[model samples]
Target: METNGKILKAGIILIAVLVVLGYLGVYLLTIKEPVFIKHYIEEQIYTGYQQGPRQVDLQLYYITNAGDNRVVSRVDFPEYPEIQVPASEYGMHGGFMTYTSGPQQTPGSVKGRYSMRTVYLGFSFEEDYYEETIEITKAVIHLSDGSVVETEIGSVTFHFDEERSEVLESRGGSGSGALETREFSVKEDIELIEVFSPILPVIQDSLEMKINGRDFKDIEGMNIEAGETFLVEANTQGSRGSQAFGEELRYLKFQPKLRFISEKGTEETRILVSGWYPIPNYEFIEIFQYLRQKGAL
Candidate 1:
């Protein structure tokens, strides 16, 4: 009976020790090193035709005191420096708008990833880079233990375009390029005169207008009533006249001489007509296809 009792007590102690060891091992595994959490930004950006002082918003996120919970030493963006601009450098327990629950918030949940310290850095790049897309290659993080880790995080491509510029294509999100409507350059005191073309550049002095899909020459002297649209092509000479005929980057302007009679028997004239549009060439090129075609990856 005594031997049997000793064996039972030893079995209970062994089971308890195994359970404690398993818990310790799992706890150690859960205690992960602070990892960088990069934000996913838009791949397509737009800027003006001309270049000037510009800014790029870059960010990095990480857990400060992860497992052992120690304060982070420093964060550096060696590729991009904060230009002369007033912005937030870094914040503690900030910019964590995602699933952020931990001992402080919830009873027992992991705190990191979405709920992390945010590091926002603004810097300028070369003009050519802004012309197309900005690529992020690497980023460095310095831990509290004086250990430095370099890693790549999130999507790295960014695009730029001016407010006036229009996007012809997009792999990112909606832009002014999505707008397809008959934008009016000039209209007499009429209620429903509009350009028929979905994308009209600008036209000036003499113009080739297509009325209802018919060349204006074919329908010369045709009296266009209200609620009608027409396409106009400039014939006036300008600096961009030597370029593409209807795709010039300059404004086409002229005096609106067309006269209209109102319903109340009053005569009104179109004062002026002008137009200007710059299609964006800031398109995204497929790097893989380009490299494959060039025989150089």
Candidate 2:
């Protein structure tokens, strides 16, 4: 009985060792690489890519170095979520992508290889209805092995035409020039990109602007709806006349506080997207909290 007990103990130890080895093998053999999507990127950088229920074309390029069985399956854009297309439509007929935003155009000759192939992946929008300029920097690629990849497609813009109009009421002269306020309602959603400050004044100590009553964050771009409030304290220049010889010949000087794009149509305000996410101003936030604690804001 003692000998049998000893043999049973030996068997248990061996099984435990085998199980650990198996786990280690599996872990070491797993793949950990990202898929890639490329375009026939020009010096133009794909400007005015467009909002679609309409079709457009580009030499869809792809690279799948993810794993042994991995193959390009699909490509898509996040900003315009409606657009998605198969990785490659390779058959006896050649190109597989037959559909686009509206019309069908034969894809150019397939290019590149398995490790890094620049094939003409038939591409188009499934359905997108948007207005204004869009910045495209990333593309998500789907792989045949059931994994997804987010790769850079470089900088690009969409639907970038605009219209500008004077719509603010100035109350009095204060901050840098005159304090201006606009009580406006958006007919649709407005995605704000920048707070347009005509002339760059030494504005560090002064409050820049506020939207929906939030305070350094507006420069990062935001979204708003009806009754959206825009408040600015200064404008160093650009008002036709005050009380001078040109008072009668006033050149309606106007400066837009919030530069944005909405569903109704594209309005004025030159756009510059520095970063997508907000870069928090810790000092400003802390100061604000302290001020509110003393009823200073």
Candidate 3:
């Protein structure tokens, strides 16, 4: 009986030791293992003279356990939203031109000269979160003449503090017209390169002007000779939101002012023109392929 008792006690101690070891092994494997997750964010800007849609690619990458790379999501940020640039209010009759004796000026007789100025502004947030204020660090303008202008004329501020994004808090004044002298002559159809700010996932704003040449005689009893110097001024404002991740767009509203003045500043005329213009829209296939090659997607 004593020998049996000793054996029984020894077996109980062995069983308790095995149970503690099993619990420790389970804890190390299931509860204490280290988990490492990494995220990569990228932004691509597209600014080409092509007639098709313009796009920006915003990609997010997720990696687990070091070598696992996967494209968790892709956002397509279109620069241009409209099928066609917004038409001026005057429907194309708004600039100075030589007069000729003909059958009352047909629309075909008048040639439209378009001047577009695009500003690419970049902003950076203090932190990765959007709750902070955005700072405007870069402002570049592409003129109609293919010349690039850099100025501090206008101010761009983005308010993400609110539920919705509010843009272009203020744009206009002597500073806004800083690129007034740089005008490009456009005949038939011309597309200005879409501007972009890489820091953010969307386009900030845009401005454009259109002038029409008409026969000096078109004006009733007004004697102005051809080749007379004239001043053309265009003031415009427009805004659009990012279309990343197939998100719905909040259509933009544009305000534009067009005017023509004689070189002497004696005569001035204001013509109604449309303010709303098209913004570039993007396609993401190429962007996706590029990122995939970089092992970022």
lDDT of 3: 0.27
Q: What digit string (tens of lDDT, one per residue) describes model 2 on residues 153-262?
A: 64443332323322322222233243433344444566776664322121222323444465534445677665444434332222322322121111112223456776
lDDT per residue, candidate 1, 112-209, as tens digits? Answer: 31123445555555556656545454566665567777765543445454442111111122213212112223222232233222112233222443
Q: Relative to the true structure, how large is the alpha-carbon lDDT of every model? A: 0.39, 0.41, 0.27
**Ten contiguous residues minimizing lDDT sum, candidate 1:** 165-174
Clash count list over all predictions: 9, 5, 15
lDDT of 3 by residue, 1-297 (tens): 999999999999999999999678444323111111111112211222233333321111111112111211111112212112222111323312345586323221111111111212222232232343322222232322344433222112232322211111112223242123222222212211122122222212333232323222132333333333222233334222222222321222222222223334332222222222232232233323322343433
Task: Supply candidate 1's per-residue lDDT for 75.
Answer: 52
Candidate 3: deviation at residue 69, Å? 19
RMSD of each: 18.3, 20.1, 26.6
Give residue 211's error in model 2 in angstroms: 42
What number of backbone clashes does candidate 3 have, counting pairs of residues 3 or more apart or in separate chains? 15
Give the local distance difference test score of model 2.
0.41
Error of 1 at 102 (Å): 22
Q: Order the candidates by lDDT, highest first — what do you get?
A: 2, 1, 3
Answer with 2 or 3, whichever has the higher TM-score.
Answer: 2
Better of 1 and 3 by lDDT: 1
